[model samples]
Target: MQYSPDSDPSYDLKIHAGFKVVRDYSFSFDKVEISFKDMVRFIFPSTGYLIFNLFFGDDFTLRFLNYDLSEDLPHHLYITGLLSRGMLITGQQGTGGGYAMKIHPVIGYHFLRIPMYQLTDRQVRLSHIFDREGRPLRQLEANASARTLNDPGVKGFFSKYLPDKSVYLRDPVYHAVNKIISKKGIIQVKKLATECCMSERTLHRQFLLKVGLSPQSYAKIWQLHFTMELLKNNPGAKLQGIAFKAGYYDVAHLARDFREKLFVPPSQFYRDVNPMMQSYLDFPDSLQ
Candidate 1:
């Protein structure tokens, strides 16, 4: 059966995401993507499914972006599928995506069919907690190890946490195109694919497979997300400042993107946040 939650306010962005204390790897229906000029961040609930994250093209070094996963990889290190179990993401900004990983939505199920099976987590494999009745628990750490995305051995037990079509896919180009789109903020698909050394048709096929949005469409979403962060943190931020910071050549360009995606002027978003010191990543945007 096809599932559509577009009408469900619970999954909408009106409230944004508040803090979620880990129980036992919580399953989420909300797949989120946020942008900040050259920086793009994606947080998706692996929600019980058989999917993998495919990153391709280019590599970069990271600074404060490093995290304490079950293990650590260089910012430019390219690995596919599960990054690490128990991923302690701490803002990493590097380049390189020619890697992909097939992650089973199940707690610790590693596919026997992957290309890099030998390079998975060493000390701790993936596993899940369960209720007495056999339901998988959320964020349980009874027998936990340093978590990494690519758990080597254990398989997930529950089957109910799968994600929807829009949230799961198998393509390596989404990140490829995203690389350029994030840097440029917006571009035509054909032009983007051309720059990536592929036909527009191939580009579209791979992009839609992973990102679930057309090239232009994703760019709009990305720009809006980045703009939101900028405007949120800098309410008194000038249009020109936001524009230049967000990779636009002029304030007019910023205004155009704002009107197009948000249906409101950039200035309108300023009055929303109050001043406060905060852990930008750990704190929910609302605490501002």
Candidate 2:
């Protein structure tokens, strides 16, 4: 069934279905809970973030790159790394719920202590990553309820893993990432390299090592994200205007990017995809 953002009860029901913000860390992460029934969501590519998912109900399936890869996630905790392409998720009818933590990629890299490139477009069980330490996290997940999910107990559990403040301030890639975001991905790689005081080649290498995606790829993702935000905020705005604002040379360029990355033209995406599904694109205020 098609869901319309307005004048449709099913759309409202699906969009509102048990979605809640458990907590907002402002600086580093967000804790949220989601429950849904027979939902299919298309998750667009991200600028860069690691998503920690804790599932508590029926299984859901994730398909990437037009089903070239598919995985079933049962009731358990999993973490997904930065995705350079869109993903499709399907949850069958009947209620299912989960908790998610969206973390900054730099912090994710420090926590995982591995080259970020290895995790690009991948999801692994939390237990697999943490080994013995994962037991306590599982226990906490088992004990959590909607009301108590955001308690200090859980917050404290994760606090120990928070990277040092200096780590963020000292990282050149982090600064470059922020500059890319601040400009809404309008800056070119050469200009970004110059501003960051590094050669284009060095910047590209560092960005891949640190964020799992090259600077140009990351910028494109952010550019798409920026376009999505504009579409969401101004549904009545013209595509041509939106394209230029999002750094595309013309509407055709914007449409080409959307077709290549999202598998749909911008017009179809704006018309068919519910705004609620794109809510994840809203970065935390701290990031802005």
Top-TM-score structure, candidate number: 2
The lDDT for every candidate, in the order shown, is 0.36, 0.62
Tens digit of lDDT per residue, candidate 1, span 16-134? 22222122333321112221124322222111112222121123222213322333232122222322322212222233321222233211222222222233322122222123422
Q: Which stretches of candidate 2 lie over 4 Å from their true place?
A: 1-47, 58-75, 138-148, 151-156, 283-288
TM-scores of all candidate predictions against the true structure: 0.37, 0.76
Q: Over the full model, what C-alpha lDDT does candidate 1 score relative to the true structure?
A: 0.36
Q: Residue 61 of candidate 1: its Cα lDDT? A: 23
Q: Alpha-carbon error at 155 in model 2, in Å? A: 3.4
Worst 10 residues of 1 by lDDT: 279-288
* TM-score of model 1 vs. true structure: 0.37
- The residue ranges of model 1 lying beyond 4 angstroms of the native Cα positions read 1-170, 177-197, 273-288
> What does the lDDT read for residue 32 in candidate 1?
25
Per-model clash counts, in order, read 42, 0
